[model samples]
Target chain A: MPTNKPSLKGKLPTELKVMERLALVEQFLAKLKVDFEAAGFRRNRLVNDGIADGLNLVSNAVELLAEESYEDADRICRVAWIRAHFARAIFDAEMTEHFLGEGVFLELDDGGTTDWRTFASEELAELQEEIVNLRKQIKDRSAKRGKK
Target chain B: MIDDVAKLLSKWLSGQRSNKLMSTVVEAMTEARQKVRASDSPFKSLARKCIDRAEDAYQEAIYQLKDGEPKLCFQHCKQGLKYISMAMLHLSDLNGNATTFAIEQGGADESIIDLSKAIAAFKTSVEYTNCEVTVEMKERLKESVRLFFLAVSFVEREDDNEAKRCAHGGLLYVYLLSKESEEKLQSNAVDAEALERCHGSAISRIVSLIDELSDTNSTLQEASVESHGRIKLYLDAARRTVDRCISAYLDNESDALSQLAKAGMMELRMARRLIEYAKYPTSTAEPEEEPIEEVDQPTDNFRGRVARLQRLLRDEDEEVAVVRRLGVVNTYYSRARALFASGELSEAERYARSAHLDIDFARQLLLDKHATYSDLI
Candidate 1:
């Protein structure tokens, strides 16, 4: 009875817990690296430069984790995660249109060029799909982490 | 539409038909095409080979007709007819049965197509704001779009004058909207702009809601000078509801807090719509038996802690990371929007406040990241 263990009284199921949203952010970084390489997109300026810059937040997150600043590390990574998700979705749509021979080069606020179609509401369903999958992934990963 | 294209084709064809060599070939192709009138033909398989070639050539010729020389257009058209004739000869070898249908081509003037597409693009450009317009300006915009549609219809009939008038009407509304935007933008100065000017804070800073809500209140107070009529009533209701909600939050009355939150949200919505409606400029002053919402100096009634979140959201331009300890706050706003769309407003509001901690905990977290988060889920 004096064991230094959490009792199973009035506890919510571990599977329903939502704390490990960071798990999804980690996976987002991993996936982006593989996707860019597979798509033959070099992580540099002139192509996906914003995403490349944003991905640096993950390294910062890891460094904070080493320093035992879990909350700040999570915040940093989560910011990077959503920002990266947006950049990835935009780039994915742009690349799709390019491959389909329907993309146009639009000028950015900064005098850069992109293959993003100016009118793009059709691909929103794809965005919702990603969000759903991400939620599922978060739940599963959170459950796994709770075991430790 | 057909008459416009046919005039061009008939004028060209009659000239071509004059040549003796062309006359003989045209006669043969005409007979071949006429021979394929059967509804059910056993020799359809035999005729298919030549018909495929004929259709391909005809399609290619149509594009040539769009831009290339009339000579190339004619050559491709003739190539298609030759294939049809060969199909006829092949059908004759199979006891003269065929299932080939007639191959006809038509073209609209390129300028007409271009103009129609341009009108569609104009329709899209109008939905987006030139700054933010008043409702009267939007009513004018609605009329403008109506005229644009009329322009599209007129262009279809090739009535250039009617189309020009409609297009001009649409552009005039747009011009008025621009003028309104210029006047509106020039006249009012917002406190939030000053807040935004405090750099190293663009979408990155931990926001304090007190500053933003005060800014919003001040801006509304400025606008409340004009005939806000019933909007003032709604704002008053919203502000009171917010105060009650904050009290409920402190008293641990979750049920009352939920009801008060929803009531406050509704009041805010009505206030917004009424403001837009009241602001619509007309020739005469609106007779308000009820006086407009009077903006008072920071009274005891306006100050509430948790209530500020409701007001802060109305600042659509508010940075997401305003409060400390953003436990999925940004995504919650977005998720709440989606849930709102799916007719789940109750759940949406819950999600929107998904990061709310105990008041004391929040205060501590504001100082540092050491807050109890039992309510996050």
Candidate 2:
């Protein structure tokens, strides 16, 4: 017990624990840099603007963290998180349109028909399929119960 | 070429139907001239002419209805109603004896005819006559006419919801007319017995039709949640439109009323979108994280990192600033990793994404070293 072996029950000094956390934070950020490069989000101007603004807040939080002003740091980090969240949402919405085409997105957004005749025909087909599925479900349930 | 154009114009004019109201007006004028020559006073003759015009309009309305033009029919009926009221006022004015008779008679009898009483009965009726008619009365008549026609149009379109809305509005006008009549009686403006004899049955019929239409609409609207929402939207839109129309009527801006009505219709369409959203629930791929909930009592390390990042960004040197900014990104990334290790996937994704954004921004700033503070700002 008196040997130099680390004990599970022992608590690390506050300074050492903080240093460990800082190192972990650094490693995590390095991995994020790699993820961003892979995602090709660097080419997005709006995202770049968001990140720049976020970094400004993040850097401020870090300084507060170093000074042990944890509350202020947390506030700044929370704000940065919100900024980043909104930026990603905007990017994702745009990406969806790019991949799915505008016409499909418009239909989903407004529940309107581009061509009423075509839409009516499609709706009729869908209704027929739904009725068939409902009938099948009823039959299966009755059979499972051994009903006459 | 000029001769050909003239011939074309003549052909078009020949093909067009004559204005129904104008035709009725001409017939009325002829009848009025004949009646004035025979009658002791021109007032009674003029009233007779109004009645004739009203009858003509009514006949035309019947023809329009047969032709499947409910809106036109409604307009004709409205004209008929207006003329009928005017005729009553004229008859009342034939002798000052009408008001005196009304005062003497107590029951609801038609014997009482007082122009002043009729004017006082409805605020709208007050505006239709100049010394003989009130402009307010004319405006109310016009509004009633519009509402009646709109209701018929909705019915013709097979839009029961909108039809009901319009019918209800028309009914309100009818009720106002009745109320005005009653007030006139109360103030001794007209004999109560006279009003009952004159306008009672017509008012009752209009009220009954309105009630029936309104009930039918309610039942239809109640069939489903979606229908109910639709009905509510239409009713609310109609109410707003009517309010606007009233204001426009008061301002005497008839043209503006049409424009406002169009705007109201546009707003109704927009509200339909809100109704759709309210009726259906949207789906999200992933479960939402309580990021805010977690931050209510943030951990010590989280606070420390935030503080450090804030300090780093404030550095004067651009290079140091970039490094510190990167460090801030790292802090969030580290938090995401910890959350990920704890199996909080949604929270982890959120933090990780934020970290990625910061890194990209920092890289961009580093690449554009020549960018000034003003550019960043």
Candidate 3:
């Protein structure tokens, strides 16, 4: 009988558990490699299937941020973070059709996104007054921020 | 058991020693990239020198280990460690992201995964280090383990207060290691209270730092006497606990290596915390223009900024203080923009100059304050 090899798995960290998942995916791909190639899976084609759904979520987030949709922006912000992580994982796996599902994308309460344009005059005025207090030190960014 | 211990020590040393070489390779590649990015020639010579040193140390360490001179092997390991650290420093200087280590691993979660790996490695090194090595050998292993902990902690996100809470758990991990090693060496029960105190002190110091910043900002908002007292109270409590832990560790009867290893690890964790503070983003709203006469009056936000600046400056860390000052200048500039909008041109000009001067001051202060573990060595 062959001598038993050291069980390195027990010594590994929690992250290695994910690696096992990837390994399973690899094993499956190996069997499907012939079928995949025969079925017209082009090796050169970068597949991003359901990823667009995820990307759309993030894209919507970027839009919300640009629109100063704070409440919506905040909700999308969390989604975008998850989307970015998922997109990265899918990209790593070289999969085309990975995307936003209920399990993948945690739902946030629907609310009006923050509209940057709606900086209430009171809050804006208060911020301005505070700036006046700090005085001469803040002028450094006038050119950068485009404040004439 | 002796052979097993030696084998483990040799393996640990060799792993670190190889990393030293790998770090060199990374440095050379990074340096070349930097030169390409900036079209600058400055890093090329330094990179070449580091590569040569790393190669020499790499060869020497392997030869010594093969010859079974663990002491020589250890020294060569240190040499390799130095070169790797130098490479990392160069990479940091070149504006490489901390996450690049994992990114180069070819995946998104790799960075976090690598962090987990590093934590696991340190934990294993500590667990197996029992009854196996000489006091000196234990110290060396502990030092390497501590360094790895710092490397992991450096990647922690600061702005998420909850993340900070989770991040300090790594510090507790190190404290446990120290306690475990102490128990093994001294054949006495490790003081659970002492370890607990260290963990408690670290958390309290961080929390107090946050509280003080909040209070300072609040006080400055009102420019009130009560606010100042609150800030003072928080700072005093934080300082007492932080100082007591530092003094206790330094004065302890533990062997120099373990004590120093523990202290260095703790300091690195503290440094990481301060670095996180420096990098934390603030609200980026563009302040509207306001009048100069209105500039002298403090607001809650203004006090918050002041409190943050004051707390940052209070950190004994030079780099942290320097970076915080730059942020303070930026905050001032944001205010100036608002002032200028209100036609307070004179006040805006003053704030602008102050921001510039503060940036210059920060640079000087950082140069004076910046230090590394090599400095302790």
Measured by DockQ, the strongest candidate is 3
Error of 2 at B265 (Å): 22
Give the TM-score of each candidate: 0.21, 0.19, 0.24
Candidate 3 lDDT at B319 equals 47
**Model 3, global lDDT:** 0.37
Q: Write the per-residue lDDT of candidate 3 for residues B192-307, one digit (tens) a residue.
A: 33223334444444334333333333333332343343333333333333333322332332344244334433433333333333333243332222211222223323433333
> What's the iRMSD of model 1?
31.6
Relative to the true structure, candidate 2 has a C-alpha RMSD (angstroms) of 39.6
Fnat for candidate 3 (0 to 1): 0.01
Models ranked on DockQ: 3, 1, 2
Q: Using alpha carbons, what is the TM-score of model 2?
A: 0.19
- Candidates' interface RMSDs, in order? 31.6, 41.8, 21.9
**Model number with the top TM-score:** 3
Measured as a fraction from 0 to 1, the native contacts recovered by model 2 come to 0.00
